[model samples]
Target: MQITVKLFATFREGRFKQADRDYPIGTTVANVVDDLAIVPSEIGMIFVKGRAAEMDYVLKENDALALFPLLGGG
Candidate 1:
């Protein structure tokens, strides 16, 4: 399956802003995060096709997955 991943905030520091990547049919959001070397604790929000999604949410072909990093402000 091909998934489009979008990274936000600090998540794109050393990674791309968006890209289409291939994964197995049973791949989940957590799997993609792990593959990108992102710590789970650093994730602030997740969206699949513009809807809120969980880490264990299974990805489907052509799904748009967005990941946001934890934000801090004083």
Candidate 2:
């Protein structure tokens, strides 16, 4: 299945802002993050198809995913 991944903030540094990737059926959000070399601790939020999703959320074909890194600063 093919899915779109959108990166935000620092997450886009040295990486693309968006991409279309192919993964096997039943692939989870965590798998994509790992493939992108993003650690779980750096993830602030995940959205799948515009809805908040967990790392264990299964990715569906043509799904759109957005990843945001943890924000800091007072």
Candidate 3:
């Protein structure tokens, strides 16, 4: 299936801000992250279809996913 990924802030600095990728059926968020080399340090928040999603979340065709870099606000 194909999915859209959006990167934010520093995540976009070192990675793809938007992309369309293909994966086998039943692929999970973590699976895609790994495939795209999206390390934990590059992921601040993750959203799937406008909602927060866990790493184990499964990705569907045409899903709009966003990954933001973690901000340190003290």
Candidate 4:
């Protein structure tokens, strides 16, 4: 399956802001996170097609995923 991944905030450091990636049919959000070496604790949000999703959420072909990192400011 082919999915579009978008990264935000600190998550984009040394990585792309967005990209199209290929994965197997059963790939989950957690699998992509791990593949990108993103620490789960650092994730602030996960969205699939503009809707909130969990780490275990299974991906579908042409799905768009957005990952945001925890933001801290005063």
Candidate 5:
């Protein structure tokens, strides 16, 4: 199984912001976050397959996953 991941915002400075990586099938979006050693607070938005996805979303091979920081005002 293989997954391509894209990291944005502060996540880029972490040890898991690689453009792509390989993980076992049935990996959830949250698993990817965990692999990156990312804390929940640092995580903003999650886009799976071009749509807003929850952490429980089961990731499929070749699925495009994107992570971004939560938008804030002021």
Candidate 6:
């Protein structure tokens, strides 16, 4: 299956803002995160096809996944 990943905030640092990634069937959001070298702790929110999604959420072909990093500010 092919998924489109969008990165936000620090998540985009050194990485692309968006990308098209291919994965085997039954792949989950966590798999893509790991493949991108993004630690789970760094993730604040995840959206799959514009809806809030869990890390374990299964990815479907052509799914649009967005990742947001934990934000810190005074």
- Which should have the higher lDDT, number 2 or number 5? 2
Q: Which scores better on TM-score, 1 or 5?
A: 1
User: What TM-scores do the predictions have?
Assistant: 0.93, 0.92, 0.83, 0.94, 0.85, 0.92
* Best-first order by TM-score: 4, 1, 2, 6, 5, 3
Model 6, 3-30: lDDT tens digits are: 9999999898999999998999999999
CA error at residue 2 for candidate 2, angstroms = 0.4
Steric collisions counted per model: 0, 0, 0, 0, 2, 0
Q: Which candidate would rank higher by lDDT, 1 or 6?
A: 1
Estimate, for each residue in 1-74, the C-alpha lDDT of model 4 and write its tens digit: 89999999989999999999999999999999999999999999999999999999999999999999877679
Off by over 4 Å in 6: 72-74
Weakest 10 consecutive residues, lDDT, candidate 5? Answer: 11-20
Q: State each model's CA lDDT, in order.
A: 0.95, 0.95, 0.82, 0.96, 0.84, 0.93
- CA deviation > 4 Å runs, candidate 2: 72-74
Lowest-lDDT window of 10 residues in candidate 3?
A: 8-17
lDDT, candidate 5, residue 37? 81
Q: Across residues 11-45, which tens digit of lDDT does each residue of candidate 1 receive? A: 99999999999999999999999999999998999
